[model samples]
Target: MGGLAWLTPRKRSATARSVLAGEAAAEAARKTEHEHESEFPTPGDTRAAAFFDLDNTVMQGAALFHFGRGLYKRRFFRTRDLTRFAWQQACFRIAGSENPEHMEDVRSSALSIVKGHRVAELMRIGEEIYDEYMADRIWPGTRALAQAHLDAGQKVWLVTAAPVETATIIARRLGLTGALGTVAESVDGVYTGRLVGEPLHGPAKAEAVRALAAAEDLDLDRCAAYSDSANDIPMLSLVGYPYAINPDNRLRVHARENGWRLRDYRTGRKAARVGIPAAAGVGAVAGGTVALVALQRRRR
Candidate 1:
């Protein structure tokens, strides 16, 4: 009892005050959480849009590769076609598709086979291809983000370099607003196998969004865009909110410099399994050494 001098009235008062302050903070936190429960964009009903870049953003891998598998199974081409495409796919996955040469090469090769086929046939095959391959590959996080935008009453569109048929199938399956993709000309409902314009890539993607915005009366300042590749910087820049999901190297730097938000959905195990050697964007950033390594592993 003689050593109890420290337990004065002041000390007891301070302890009670600390307990009350903690309770007050907890109550404030609960109120904030309740207020944000419906915090997604739709409550204001803005005339905004959500643009998503397909390939590696929504799906884990190349959309064209899965489309090629669908085409192959339907005998739209031969075994040699698959071999050639596989080689191209390996180079593409390793080197990345932002390179103009790579994009042109891929476009030329794909268009050559799609020529002279019936539009209906390709559309049917696209449905099957998406169900069998693409459906499972959809990233849950990206999907949720898109759905959030849709719930907010903003338009959600998938932008890709894939064929219109395949892109449409994916959009319809996912219940998105629409999709913009490379257009292959068809004559009398049969594939003429020629492109109406360039592949919707790089700057072209931005242009497409602009066209859509003009047509749909959307305010770009309220819009949002998401992508994985540095190639989509043009498109991302067109929006108010840009998310670099699973961003590549060049994109990572750009996002950081511009103070853009980023989310990484690619787990370490998948990165290791893919033999990426470094971050997904390393090949695009450091040197072709990483690209060479990735290509070699894919070959195996």
Candidate 2:
């Protein structure tokens, strides 16, 4: 009955109803934040935790894009969906942040891809995908930083807009505390293709950190955050120690202005020779992906 409440509501578009439903799911996560504690004991500094962004900060490229590729290989989605993911990945790799328009398309397509899929099935595949696509892409410098936090007896979490299941798998693989990511709505262990709240991006990322902090009895002044995009400034600002890792242009400038510490692993001759052209190539492919997505939808 609760899930069907939207059916009895006053005038609301399908998009609006989806948003409202997601918000309700997010509220539930907030209320239960405390219960989602790290299974590993924090014996050293229990009040502090380090939060790392998934893309470009911890991993080399878009985590979702990698996941999508893995899913595509398994025939979980059609070729058009994969193309859309490639466009998003390219934009992210080049600009170092999400394009709002692409993100909306991605959100819709991502939901469509998972509709009617079992949660357990996705989780099982996600584990394999991580080993195949993500394991080698982790930035060693970022891994060490997270390790330092763990050594200090503090929790370390990955907070990203990627699906929570995927994020959790990465955290577990890395031997970190846990992750906070966008939730996909599920019923009877099957995905309903709707999100739980918004994707955990931008201001929403900060909000999630705050909720987790409150729930885990963490001190914001003792916590830290790392990211590669200016879009994450809100989350970065919330921590006592903020770092810009492999930052894009806007983030680099903003970090300098704010006196946030910056680290760039993609330096030296190799990056100079190959990086710019690679980024440009990625940005150029978005148009084709968008067209393909539209065509696929029409065919359906």
Candidate 1 overall lDDT versus native: 0.69
lDDT of 1 by residue, 168-264 (tens): 6787788776677777777899988676555777766776777667655678877889898898998899988788877777887799899987765
**Tens-place lDDT digits, model 2, residues 1-300:** 355466635433443443443344244444333355545555676788889998888899888889889989999889878988998888877766667677777777878888999989999999999999999998776787777677667788888888888988898788887787888889999999988756777777887788778767899887889998888998899998788777777777788889987665554542344332223212213422432343234335
In model 2, which range of ten residues has the least summed lDDT? 275-284
What are the RMSD figures for all models against the true structure? 22.3, 12.5
RMSD of 1: 22.3
Superposition error at 32 for model 1 (Å): 41
What candidate 2 gets wrong by more than 4 Å, as runs, is: 1-39, 267-300
Query: lDDT of each model, Cα atoms only?
Result: 0.69, 0.75
What TM-score against the true fold does each predicted structure earn? 0.74, 0.78
